[model samples]
Target: MNKSLITNLVAALLLVAGVLLNNTLLSLVGLFALSGGLTNWLAIHMLFEKVPGLVGSGVIPAQFEAFKNAIKTLMMEQFFTQANIDRFVSGQDSQVHLHLQPVIEKVDLSPSFDKLVDVIMNSSFGSMLSMFGGASALTPLKEPFVLNMKQSLIELTQQESFIELLKNQIDQPNVMAEIRAKSKKLLMPG
Candidate 1:
């Protein structure tokens, strides 16, 4: 078991023993046990509450909201952004196989491939070719496109900031808070 579980179990055991023994020494042990158990309970409670009757407690959630926000910001910036994957291009001079995996791990390549096929079919060249050709003519294009996308993603991941930003963002409150506090005086609405 983990340290917390072990400590909790020990506290419970001490409390039970102390209550059963019924003496001054046992009372002291009971107090120690109770303090541990109560403190742990209060700590857990404070995580989600403004503890109704407490004198000064239950500020964990509100006070650390920035910590939660920073985590959300990290998730959005690193794993849910289109810009992260779109930079990886390998097609023509400007076109690239933007890998969605970096930002969107859940990608359905078939739909995209099908959309490409539809676009090709709707094009003038595609219409002329299809008038005399078959759908099999475009089957060879799918794998190459997928492979190009893979290569582009590989290229983008090599950027140092891609992974570094995760740590940098986590550490931002410590580094940027001072700078932000100082810069705030510049905006006095004069």
Candidate 2:
């Protein structure tokens, strides 16, 4: 039925015919054919089936778990690492836009305005402001200043040049590594 069985049968017939007809050539050919065919068949069999007194046969079925683990180790160590993933993401052709408007809008700019007022008061302008009702004169401008600052930040962040700059910085090797490290730390905190 199978090639190995058919080969063995043909070889045995040749051997018998050689012996009957007293032909050395046929005998040697038959011997070589039988040996080679049997040897190859045994080797193929050993890969998937066990045999008595054989040291390393049936390796696939017997050590399937180890084989699976080896494949997993190879993929994780060589292909699926953080650096590899970063390279894949950074190698994309499309633009990377960072939407920071929400964060910018949510930021409290009152402290920044207060700092500006303090700086003005500490400078030679302090005496000039005292005559205009001290820092209260700037009080009416606080809400407008905060709103304007937030709007300016949102506009700056939404600019194409700013987005491109951010993309370049993020794509840098050191910055990517730091981001990966921080993300890993957050995901797998100890």
Which predicted model would earn the best TM-score?
Answer: 2
lDDT of 1 by residue, 64-158 (tens): 76766676567655743444322322123354433435663344466677788788777877877686564567788787876676666666665
Pick the lDDT winner: 2
Candidate 2's residue-wise lDDT over 1-190, tens digit each? Answer: 8878998999988888888889999988888888898899999899889998898999989998788778766765686577675665564535534579899988999999999999988999999999999888889989999999999999998887887787777778787777766655554456
Query: Please, what is the TM-score per model?
Result: 0.31, 0.52
lDDT against the true structure, per candidate, is 0.60, 0.82
Which segments of candidate 2 are over 4 A away from where they belong? 1-95, 183-189
**Residue pairs that clash (backbone atoms under 3 angstroms), model 1:** 89-96
How far is each candidate from the true structure, as Cα RMSD in Å?
Answer: 12.4, 15.3
